[model samples]
Target: MLNTSEHPWKLVGPWYRPSSLGGYAVTKTALNRFSAPIIQKYADANFANNLVNEPQHSLRFNSEDFVQPFSGDPNQVITPIERAQSHTPLKLYLNTHSRFYVVVCELHCDVAGFPQVERNKVCEAGFVVRRRVPVITPELKGKVETLLQQRSQLQNDLNKVNMQVKTAQLQESQQSSDISGLLKTKSARLFSGLQSGTAEKLTEKLQDTNGQLDQLSQSGDIKIELQGWKSSDLKGVGNWLPIEETPEQITEQVIPMYPLIADPTNPNHSANGKTLWFGVIPTSLADVDSNNNPRFDDADLYEIRCFVRRHHSQFPIQKNHTDCCGDVIWSEATEGYQIAAHFDLDGTSHRPVNIKLPDLPAIRNQVNNAPAGRGASARIIAPAESSLNFATDSMDMPQGGEPLTRAGQQICFFSIFLFFIVAMFLFRLFLPILLFIFNLWFLLKLKFCIPPSFQFDAGLVGSLNFDGSFGADFNASIDAHVELMTEFTADLAVQVAIEGPDLEAKFNQPNFSITVNKGKDNEKTYVDEGVLANDLGLMIANGINASDDMRADIKNGGDSPGLSSLSLNELAGIFIAMQTEYQDVKHPELAGILPTPDSGLVYFEKVELNKEAA
Candidate 1:
């Protein structure tokens, strides 16, 4: 909760009142307290005392002091005209008691009714103070110096380590160059028939070199070693200190005066005029007791903040229109024109008068229609196929023609048939040549095709010769045997031809004739039982009687024996035999001359075999 007590310096008056009467009496007293003459007297006394006590130290004054008496003749005095000419209407010293006070005036008016003429009067006035006090003690100063020295030492150590890192990096670079040279040497020796012992020794040396390089790489990573250095280890390093509570944190309090109070006769009327208000307000109320009264000797009175409010036109100008209804209107609108001024006990004040409002309309338009102006157009045309149109008007053709004679038709038909026959014969004769040409062209194309970088070495290592001749001696012998073989001969005799002619008779009755044929057949059959018996004995002795009853039964649709009939030992033996056979077939030695087969599926198997061997 905030206290809402009226400020002691609040003053109010009507515009018709004299400056010396009523609330104006207090205003006159405050003005005389901080008058120019009084401020000058204080400044001059301080300047003289500072010179006598600390002559070695230069005296300092506010910028408003046009003529510094300490810088010139200590006895010299500056005139009021000279001070005004220097743009300093009032010359005051910050250390003087009058510097911390300020006067504010406000005007009030009625904004609800008809227009009326009224003098400007002061509605309210007040004074405020604000100041900064030193909180750094002697013990804190000693601790700060110690912290700074520690920081400096830490920086020096860091620089030393950085230098060492640079040196190590240079050494690593040289080692890298040496390793590169060694690699080149090793590659050359590997390809140039280097001895096995020498190559093995070089490889060992390279491994050791690589180990050294790895160590160098690990050594350069100093970040892990630096983990012990923590910023929290420094002095005065912790969570941020909370804001210290001060008396200046009090909220601004306003006190109403007589003019602001409602009166039955005056109603909402108020005269506008400037009124002065002044009093000593403590910048800090830390010295105040429980009774809300501050000790002037112990209270801070070097700074003050004044808040002033004045009434302005209550009716805002309507957008796109400018009419006020021809009447002045006023309201008790607390959110009126406000001015905040900060006055320090040191003769300086900070008052912000210029304020800028943001342009929201332009920003809103830009965001809503950023890309409204962008547009695009496109035209697409479909492709048309090439075409040809021929004109038939140029062609010469008879609309009607006479029929050919029979001979002419026969001739035309024969000629047509002959032309077809000849054409077919020529086609058949040239078909083989055309096919040969096409085949030759395809073969030439294949021969000229681009080849890949890798190719199989299918070239034969040696020439092959095939013997195709038959045995000449064997054929000659067969021909000689055929020449030596005898030929069959047949002889016929006609000695009784004349004698049989006399005995011959012809029968005329239906040419009937009886013919008697006489034939003599002589056949001799010889049976060699002994030879047959010998041949039978030899056939019997040479015959083989072999049989597979199980195979025969299976062929006849009988079930074969199952492995379940075998003992466990027997089954194990069979399994081992199968595994051994598989191993024998897949062994590397049986992989032919090449490690991989022609199909390349055995490449992984070969690789595994090599790995096992290595």
Candidate 2:
């Protein structure tokens, strides 16, 4: 029996024969045991009898003129349909025989499409055919199961290795962070230590010393002789006249022994043609006696001595030229000529003595009273005994032993004071040397206290571990003993013809895939020990080498070490020599040292003369 709910089929043809008879009828029914006989009887007796008896006339009808039971194109192919589903009819045929007419129809069935099948044999046979049977052997199944289990184990091992690798990476990262922090701290400490230690102190000291030396150099006195005069020439001179006083004198006189021209405009001219010569008399004989009387009579004037001065304005004069009177001497102050010639008043020399008569009324009266024709040369001579007596009496000398003893005591006290001043000066001069010696000893002691070398350990240890992996597989197989069988049957006899282009279909099997993975795991750990110690050692070695080089430079008297190259004794000696030379050159008066004689003093002289002799 076919259940109507499961199989939906409809019947359309129960046509009567004659045109007078009614049109065909359509009904939906189930082919079940209860309704089957009634349906068959109606079709065989009533419908068939009417068709056989009345169908002598021909009938023509278009398929399109009738309403189709189903919608869509009847000629369209429907593929890949499921089994037992209903399909539309494509064509219908009618036949007549001696007994009755028959109707035949060509119909399509709905069957699922198979891409693996090449022909319609399966559909025609209505069942698949198998030539060989395919089966899974127990041994093969067991092997596959074992392989799967092994793969699972390998996956589990890989997971564990991944966890271990992650842990190692974490440890390495932490260790690196710690090392970086430690290095930062250590570097800061090293820098601070170097900044605050011996090198810094030494640099500061050197800078201070250099600054002091610069100040001294700038502030110390410098001696310059602007007048081009030697120290001896300036000995008794209070101050030099300005250059404006002697504008024509640009350079020092090269031959000062020779007298200079008295007047630039009149070099070869004298003051007057008539030369009035004079003689300089001794002060002892030129002054009056205590009685204010002349010491020599006119006849005794022959014993007097006198010098005459020459008058000339000519060059190339001899030192002792006596053509007219005596040697000529020039004076810058007087801007005139003088002489150094002397004569005896006893008439032993031919030179005339032109002495100016003393301005006394008594002497002038005696000269005027002389007889005009007597040829008597009246002269006045003062006594030297009275002037000597006055000088001797004017001097105040210590009169007794007590005053002399007091003077001696004063000299002793002054000597003691000078001794103490000298001692103090000596102490000051040697103070730098003493201090340098003390500092050197102290520094040597400190140097000896330090150890030559040092050792240190960081006490650090590190370890690391890591692991990882990859794999792929491909499998393909064909069944050798399996086949498919199919069968098909149809009751109606009909011919089918395919039209137009032949139907063609192409199918391709899907491609298989393979996956490849590449993995790598590597781990390394490093531990550095005594990093600080190594750095400190290098610093110390460098410092020691520098110190050694400095010491060698000092001992070798090289200027690389600057003033340190000089020993305390040598430095002291140099300072003392410089001080002595400075004093001698710039402050000879302070030391009671006289100026050294030079050629310039030979032409200039400074002296005090009595008023009567002037």
Candidate 3:
């Protein structure tokens, strides 16, 4: 225990958070900072200078002779601003890194007789900016430092739990592998059964190992890391599956309108997942025909079929479950369900196929979704279909034949002209209402784009080739196989995205809507709160800047102030509070070291301390 400081300073704290605009990857501890005047000066002069060095206003009149044109006494013309006057205006530069202080109720004396201190959680930090150092007041530093140390200690406990889970899995795998060896090596002796040994016992042991292996496979923790394999090194990989099953992971990912990083898998960067599928503008890509249409080849369609099935299977086929390809085989290896789809891309929901998943040898791997199910879902994980061939028909309003006007049971052309003039007046009065109705109809049609327009019959018509490997496009694979039912209906080619915990729908028009089902037993749909925020921000930011929201994005992308921009010292306070909250609200087992805070512990007098210490 440590002794309390004789005098304590009053201080405030602020915390740092990942700047929300760009999804900058930030850990809980890494936060922005702020401070009052005195502390803010210290940070600007010391911290920002260290990170980036440059003089301000030094080159005000570049080319020295320009000063000759203005020959007044400099002192008379310029009254020097007082330091206090300059500092009071609050020009704060948040030092992303700074610390705060806490109270030290306990003391341990070193050989020099000056006591070494433990942190004081109760002390007030009056650390101010503008004065030299943040007023750490010998005592506050002790407490803040101690709290930081304690937090480091607590995080270890959380890591240990994860490590324990990993270790247990490894041990189980080893035990099963050993049993498999025993069954193979000592088969004859084990089968003799003369000395209480029976084939059933061996079979039971084998089943146990197989079951263990199966459980481990579905454990969702087996992250198979692969070395970059060249064509030369593409030899048979061991019992481990092939890496060919991952590209579909990229397509299923939902990125918002934000720009994507090339090879975005690097751990250093954070990228948005729920992006619009039509992010690429119609004319922005490599090439388009005279009709401004891009091509989605038949080969791409076949390739997409193999992509979806190779990774997912066994999803529930209930109404609430994701709509998967009906013909694909279901297994634990592919953990998603299948559904029959029918797409009618002919400007009507008329053609429908018994949408079947063709067999592809790629059914080799499926990884678990991230923690709290952040990783993957069946809806967004479509089998890599290309949109190059999808048709983009223009929609024009219908025009009626010439009209006739009837007056007193006599229809005449001159009366028709008078009626037309009156009709124009009525149209002007109801134009907006008519537009609203049309837009509402289009939105409703977008919602049903998938089922009514995109399902196809996928049966082995007459001995189809079941071989899995083929060219990049599945065209050859389909060409080799034959389906008895040649007839099929096409509906709107809709897509879905399972981004993080949320799901969204993509219509052929490629506009987006929210997904309403999680395809789980409890029947939940992942809601997208970010999209709502994005939409509101777009409207608001657009109005504020008098330009497109994308322009606002460029202006604020790297320098956005985030939700809060406290002064440097204030940030330390915020982070401390956040860290404290993270500790306070953690599960009981997770909050082992921190004093169990409650109404009783809120006040100082209620806290019992070892006052007997010198």
Question: Model 1: C-alpha RMSD to truth?
Answer: 53.0
Off by over 4 Å in 3: 1-534, 542-602, 607-614
RMSD of each: 53.0, 73.7, 35.6
True-vs-predicted CA distance for residue 558, candidate 1, Å: 99
lDDT of 1 by residue, 1-614 (tens): 11111211222222222111111222222232221101111223243333223211122222323211211222223333333322212222333322231222222222221122222222223332322223334545564445435544433333333333343333334433575445434433332232234435544554454454345436552111100001133332322122222222323232221112222353222221222222232222233323434322222212222322321245443423223232211111111011111243122321112323334576467647766432212222223321222234459442344332222212111223334456755654543233233322122111111121111111100000001121234334544322221000000001111111111111111222222111211111113323222222221111111013321221122343323333322322222222121123323221222111111111011111012210
Between prediction 1 and prediction 3, the one with superior lDDT is 1
Ranking by TM-score: 1, 3, 2
236-301 per-residue lDDT for model 3 (tens digits): 221211333333232221111111221345332211121100011110112323343322111111
Best by lDDT: 1
lDDT of 3 at 276: 8
Model 1 gets an lDDT of 0.25
Task: Provide the lDDT at 64 for model 1.
Answer: 28
Alpha carbon lDDT at 359, candidate 2: 44
TM-score for predicted model 3 compared with the true structure: 0.12
Please say which candidate is ahead in TM-score: 1 or 3. 1
Tell me the TM-score of model 1: 0.16
